[model samples]
Every structure is written in C-alpha cells, then in structure tokens.
Target: MSVTISFNNVIKKYNDKPVISGLSLDIKKGEFFTLLGPSGCGKTTLLRMVAGFNSIEGGEITFDDKVMNRITPQHRNIGMVFQNYAIFPNLSVKNNVAFGLKNRKIPKDEIERRVDHILDVVQISQFKNSMPENLSGGQQQRIALARAIVMEPNVLLMDEPLSNLDAKLRVDMREAIKLIQHEVGITTVYVTHDQEEAMAVSDRIAVMNSGVIQQVGTPREIYQRPANIFVSNFIGRTNIVERSLKKVDNRQVLIMDENYQIDLDDITQYAEEIIKVSIRPEEFTISDTSEGMAGVIQHNVFLGINVHYTVQLSNGENVEVTEESTLGEPLEPGTEVKLLVNKEKINLFHYESEKNILEGDSYAK
Candidate 1:
C-alpha cells in the first residue's frame, strides 16, 4: 500500500559536519514528490535518509504513522532505482525484473505472473527474453523500474535515475517513468538535479540549496512566483534587476529604469525604497515604441519555435528575452528596441533578504 512520508526536524552529519539540518517535510501517499537542486545540496542525502541507507543523527522519519529512524533498509520494503540500471548484466529482461521476487522465494507461478504484468506496465514485455547486454539503456532502466514496482513496496525512491541517459532518451524515459508511477499509484520520492525533469514529473517539488529547502510548490507556483532570488534564477532564465521605488504624486512607482516606471498598486504605500525584481525572459514585451524601457538588441539566436534576444538596457545590463518565431527574419544585432514588463507577472523582492516581498507585502507588516 502507498504510505505518506514525513520528516520532522531531520538532521544528518558527516565527520561532525552537518549536511542537512532541521529539515521537515510531509510527502502524501501516492504522490510524486521530487527533491531538486544542484550538486552537493543534500537532496540525495535526504532521499537516502528516507530509504534508510543513511543514518539520521537527529529528528524522525516516518512512514504513515510508523517511525522509521531505526528501521533497516531491507525491513522498510522500499523500492529504489538508481542512476545505474542495477540490473544483473547476465540476466534477460524478464529475469532481471523477477530477481527480487525470486529472492523473496515467491512461488514460481506468482513470480512469472507478476513479472509478466510489470514488464507490460513498463512497456518492456516485448523485450522479455532479450538479454540486458542487447537492450538499449532506456530498456534496461525500464527493467529496473519494473523490478522496483513489482514488489509493491510502500515507497519508491529514484536517485538521479536518468542522469546517465542521453538528452533525448532522458526526456523519453522521464515521461515513461511518470506514466508508470501513475499506473502503480505508489508513493514516490524522486531525487534529481535536473530542474526540467523535476518540473515535468513531480506533483510537488522541494527545491533545495545548501542543505535547505528553498521552496516547496508546484512547478507553476515555483516558476511563476519563486520564494527567492535563488529559486527564480535556478528554475529558469530571468533578468533580476535592482530598481528604486518612490512615491510619485501620492503613488508608489517602481522605476524599471530612468525611461520606464510601473505603478505599484495596493501595497505601494508600504514598499521599500529599493526593490529587487525578477523578470522572466517571457515577462518582457518587446516593442518599437519609445515610451517603454530603452534597450538595444545585441544579438539573437533562433531556436525554431522561439527566438532568444539579448538586449542591453540603457543602464548597461544585458537581459535575455524570448519571443515566438515568425516567417519574418529575426532582427539583426544593433537594433534599437523598447521593452515593457508584465507588472502582474513580475516578482518583487526585498533588497536585504532577497526574499519575494510579493509573497506578503513586507511594508504592510
């Protein structure tokens, strides 16, 4: 059965150095939760904690209502898939998937039944008799997944399971893995450093940095309204600019630059003098009208469906902008342009905290 996983003030240390400190989170049953971040951020460390592979120096990790701190990995009945396929190289696809069931001494017929069913579920049944040496990297990974799921474990943990695959194959396997996880309806804790992979597969994502969870939210929430400057910069391409806010004629106006300003409605009265803003590449609208922020196009890259333009603002900072590609040729370098930002979509942060002030008006407090 699927189970909820909880981390209560969890801590992990190595050689007396704390790697993860006071980390607490709840993962719902049957949910695809991903721990995402760059290398050395403790995401994998935390995942290993859940799997009982790593020791917990402090706090508790629970599955449903059971405390798992002292539980052995074997007793945990958790399914784990790793970056390496971890399938026996000498075994056929069918045998690889049946290895776990066989080890448990399950009845021969039952093992055959389960092996057949899961192989189909992961779409590798056609390669059942094929040896691991003959199967593609993606196919072998499917065997790993099928073996993990066939046991019907309480939780499934995948650690950088796709990192070894080529770019195109990584995309394909991630989609397949997400689909298989849904079909199994098992609680899954996925760990990955790839942001796009996490966004694509996770029901909720906890973005980690320096052993801390920077933000926990759906892909859209994190991408649209990141918790801080780090999250905004990590998830996608954004132009973070420092701008001044001033009360102009009884209104709070944010100066995008000397040439452009936007009214900060409602909470404007409480805003600080200096505001940090994260404007995603798509948030900027390019126009020829001189009324908006002044910029000059430095270069352009054509990416089939979209054209990415590098614009140097009048103040000398360069920002990337994305626009849909058209039949017309892209504008050449040295083109003068005007840029307008989507006020509602832009995010404002506190200068000192680097935290999204729009999360709750800092001045209003």
Candidate 2:
C-alpha cells in the first residue's frame, strides 16, 4: 500500500526554541525520499512528527488527502525501522517478524503465511527460527525490516537504520533495503546525517541545516549545482575563494584577490557584488606552465586510487585537489607550481547574502 505524504508549513518546538520551522515537503507515493542533516538540524524531529511521535505546532500533515493531525500512530498505518534495530532478543526471528501481525489479531494461518513470505523476501527464511542474538548485525537488521514491512504499512520511515552496522555491512544492507523497497513499492521517508548514504539511496534528498531545509534535489543536481555556500561546502569538498568583483570591461567583471585576477564574463543578474567563488577539487589541474594561477605545493597524500595535493596559492590561500594519479614524480612540499582553474566550473555567490545566485531567486531565501 502507498500514499502521498505532505508536510505543509510544519513547525515543531521545545521551550519556544523552534526545532522545525515552517518546513514544507511532499513525498510521492512509492518514492524514496530522505531527510538529511546533522544532529540538532531537526531531521529526526520532522520524521517523528510524520510518525505521530511528536505533535505539530502550526502546520498540517496529510496522507492520501486525509488530515492525519488527529490520527494515532498505530491507526496511521506507518511503519518505522530505527537505528538500533529494535527486536526482541529472546524471540526467534520468525517469532519476532510475526509479533506485529499477532498483535493486530491476524488469523493464525494467514500470519504464518505472511511471516514466511516476508522472511523469504528478506532472504532470512532459513534463519527464521534463530534468535536475534545468534545472528550477525546485518541479519538482525534484516529482521527488523521484515518486522516493519510485514505490517504492510502505507508509509515506511527509516531513521538511520543502517547506522549500527560496520561500513561494509552498511553498504550491503542499503542495497538490500533498496531492492526490497522497490519490490514492495512503499512510500518511504529515510532520515540520516550521512550524505553519501542519502545520495546513494534516495530518489530525492532534502538537505537540512539549522532547523530549515537548505535545498532539495536529486543527488546529481545537489552535487553538481548547490543552492548556496553552505550546501556546496557541506555536500562535497570545495575551495572557497574570497574575492571582490570589479567591472573590467563591457559586460565583464574582474575577480581580484591579493595575488590573482581573473576575468568573469556573462555575469548574471545577481552577480553585482561577488563575495566568494567555490571550485571543486577536481576542477583544478596542476601543470608546469605559468598560466591561470600560481601556487606552491604544500603536501601530497597518496590514497592508492587517488592522490590529494595541498597547494598554497600566491594569495596565501590553501586548496586541496584530488588527482587521478600520483605517478611521474610528485611535487614536494613548498614546490612552486601552476594551477589551471576551470573558469566555467566556478560557482559564484553573493558576499553579504551568502547565497549562490546561479541557483535562482527562490534558493536565495
């Protein structure tokens, strides 16, 4: 079963300090949407509100065009998988998965049939009789998922469900979750602080910060074109170049720093007072030629598949770059080198407002 979930102008607070403020979003039926942010950013609070764990202050929540504000959590038909994988330690896997159905007073034969079917879907049918303590962390997690899904809830909410497992296991488990979610086609809202995980699994991501959603977009869109300085800096590694803009010629502005000057042409409507420019690490290329910008190599780090080089620009700015190869003689510390900045790859932001004008007007607010 699937239904569209909507949070319209949602607000939540404790002691008058707003945890979630006028947050609005919509999760499509059978869509995998993620609420991603750091701790205290209100992602969990928003999720709890949807789960009916927390009360909404000044907004409305609806499911399938029905007002859910007064609905109890149980009656909401919402399934949730928490970080701890809450399962009865003493109960066997099969029993644990069947517990929810039993509580709902389902028929005995139908309960068994449904439990067996879900166990097979989770690939834990053989371990159904095994206690949770006897299973690996990943197995236990799967059991938790099986329990939630067996209820056939209209909406599934997962709160950092893979956080307890090891890194390798986390990756594997998410793949399983994605596959199972696809087969079940349940509308899902996943909450997490891990950007990579959100990007990997979500159909859309709402990046939250300071009790507000900074941006919402697909993984590629959010990564390639951030909404603001905070979004760019948080989503990936970027070198923020602080500079002032001066009109150099007709329809062109010169980006002037302490030791470098680059021409910026085809300025946008909001590019009147450029304060900062963000460039991704991969956008820089090191060479022997004295073109573009000049910098001194500070350090080189080799990570097998990629090489990270820290370069100190002539303007006393240090920037890190990731290269494809560390081969062919590395640049030692304090070595002078030239950097080629991909001008087209630069992201310009307003200084006073601290907003990326490239993202459009709605993003500025």
Instruction: Supply candidate 1's per-residue lDDT for 121.
Output: 95
Instruction: Name every residue pair that clashes in candidate 2.
Output: none
The candidate that achieves the highest lDDT relative to the unseen native structure: 1
Worst 10 residues of 1 by lDDT: 356-365
**Which regions in candidate 1 have their CA more than 4 angstroms from the true location?**
266-269, 359-365
* lDDT tens digits, residue span 154-181, model 1: 9999999999999999999999999999
Kindly report which residue stretches of model 2 are placed more than 4 angstroms away from their true locations once superposed.
Answer: 251-266, 270-272, 326-329, 359-365
> Using Cα atoms with residue i matched to residue i, what is each candidate's TM-score against the true structure?
0.96, 0.92
RMSD for all candidates, in order, please: 2.6, 3.1
- The per-model lDDT (C-alpha) reads 0.91, 0.85
Residue-by-residue lDDT tens digits, candidate 2, 261-303: 6665446464346478888998888866756578888999877
